[model samples]
Target: MSGWLPVAPCTPRDCAGHRGARRGPLPAAVLLVAGSALTLLGVLCVPAVQLLGAAHRDRLIRRWAYTVVRAFGVRVLVTGERAEHSAGELVVANHISWLDIPLVAAVLPGRMLGKREIRGWPVLGPLASLGGTLFIERERLRALPDAVHAVAQALRSGSRVVVFPEGTTRCGRGPGGRFGPAVFQAAIDAGATVRPVRVSYRSTRRGPVGVDGAPTGPCGGPSADHSGHTGAVAFVGDDPLAASLWRVVTAAGLTAEIRLLPLIPADREPGRRALARAAQNAVASDSAKRPAVSVHQ
Candidate 1:
């Protein structure tokens, strides 16, 4: 790995814990089948979806992304306002699981900024390529400028670009990795508005407690204990993709919450470093006021 590439301290052994409640083998198998089928369906539709108008295509993509997450038995709860459908906005969120990709796209369907290695993954690689993902070479610091330029060009062409500036996945229970400043330059260069989103996971189960020993509630309600469920979805260092997928399907009452924060005008920020810091701080702040949850299509 390159020195510039951001790495989280979390490992599968330490960060990913066994949940107290899990679905039976049969139910988990069914969920796995359904999630796989939905993903393949999205892949097949990509070609046709590309021919549609931008607004129509985005609507279809948003619907497909929402379904994919739900197919894995994960409830999607979105709070705060999404950025306007108009382009030239950069959507930045905390990195937790592979599910974060679809979770973010479910609300703000846009061109994704992903690591270059993901372009070679099994089913998702082709789907991401067809969906217009911008891949960056995280291992090569020399390629950073070119990657930023590509993202800036996309933004300038009136496209909403979504990026996880943390560079790698982190367990969601604690204060996770900081946002890397490089990608923020693309937003500044293109004069795009930065929309910071906070992504967190909570469980509806009663028995499993959080890392801090907070009590959990029953199904369909809020729980102070989120660590157990959050671990079920976390994709951290040295964790196999298959293991993560299995955990997600087997976990019960898992909910992914997306909190969209206020937008920061890139032009107003002193530079990319300040822009990155502002967005990170906005996402890190926990709101005391409860916001109305938006239904995911």
Candidate 2:
């Protein structure tokens, strides 16, 4: 990591490895122990989900997510109103960082549609699986149909599903990927309402610090302008998880904002593309209002 990582022992004020602590490994060690305990417990409970029931299990998962967020010392900010707890509702949001997952999980506990790669991570993989995340293999075009059906079935069963239609993470300051139309079909088939959410990250520092290890340059990406803001909160292209995690822990006074806009009712007649465009428009409009954070090249 280009930035300094605090390797010190956990203290009353620095247990979460916030910036400017005497560097050492003890703080990370503390978080690792706690995270491992939670992950193991989640994995062990996977088989008992049927007995515990989805709702109860969801509560547990949400609590776990909430704890994980606190362990990182990042603040979650809320804006606008949340959708009613109705069946077949799809929550679509812009993806900016790995933090977005747990942040959303803490707010709206439910099954998430994640990329297949997440299933292979050491601790996070098992925890996410145990939490009932549906993994989609982005490279396997043939499997997409089944994935859509699975999401629709979950919606039909009244399970709220969260999706990052951007397909990949973006720097919080720039335009996120346009929504893919495939996921919207699930809403059409299951008659689910689409909730478009805009997620953004702000740092305690000023100046455009690059997240991708690139130097500040006017040519491209988040470093395009030396806006004197830190991209430490961003988890964009080619950035390793460890580096991102380190950056997050050391970023003092970082906050993530989740704005849940009015829900869009699913069309009675099937129109996946139309629905996708509408949701995309809603998200893009709100996202544009935030300060532009360019993606690091």
Tell me, by TM-score, which candidate is best: 1
Candidate 1 has its poorest 10 consecutive residues by lDDT at 214-223
Number of clashing pairs per prediction, in order: 0, 12
Q: What value of lDDT does candidate 1 attain over all alpha carbons?
A: 0.81
Q: What lDDT score goes with residue 288 in model 2?
A: 34
Give the range of the ten consecutive residues with the poorest summed lDDT in model 2. 1-10
Q: What TM-score, to 2 decimals, does candidate 1 have?
A: 0.90
Candidate 2's residue-wise lDDT over 186-274, tens digit each? 99889888888888666554343223334432212342224433455566656677766776665555667667777888883359888
Q: Which one is best on lDDT?
A: 1
For residues 13-88, what per-residue lDDT tens digits would candidate 1 score against the true structure? 6666445456777999899999999999998889999999988998888889999999999999888875576569
